[model samples]
Target: MPASQYADMFCVEVWPENAPAWNLFEALQTQWRAGSGGVIGLDYGVLAEELRVREIPPADHEQLRADVRVMEAAALQEIYAETEK
Candidate 1:
């Protein structure tokens, strides 16, 4: 799948305004793509804590959590389809 599709799975909004947090998220994405476990290690709690430390607004943080759920569901579905095949 295209990289944009991966991004779409997680985030519908533009990049976060906080540069450091955005950078961290990008690094995490790199790790995510390299790993076989899909979203296994990419827990929402970790992400939310990082964003909280960066002082991201609560509303935006909640949106990120929702986005992660969307992404995790898509990843799980893809894994299931692949295994079935």
Candidate 2:
């Protein structure tokens, strides 16, 4: 199909300016977490939905959570030290 013809025949639906992508994603993530087992990461879920338009499985769920916890602890410590200064 020619570019111009394709555009005219199938108008690409655009998200209203009011529904910013980030806001939509946050809403969906909230819903998924509330309903699902909270077994998947938000980034992976969003990327799969928007890009692949399919479900995504958690990648190394245990490892990811562990790494996040370590990072979180370090961040908290840094903040605590900074505040004392």
- lDDT tens readout by residue for model 1, 1-85: 9998987898645445544444445544633432564444455556766676777687676655656556556766786688779
Off by over 4 Å in 1: 1-42
For model 1, state the Cα shift of residue 42 in Å.
4.2
- Segments of candidate 2 deviating more than 4 angstroms: 1-56
Q: Under the 3 Å rule for N, CA and C atoms, how many clashes does model 2 have?
A: 0
lDDT of the candidates, in the order given:
0.59, 0.44
Reference-based lDDT, residue 27, model 1: 40
lDDT of predicted model 1: 0.59
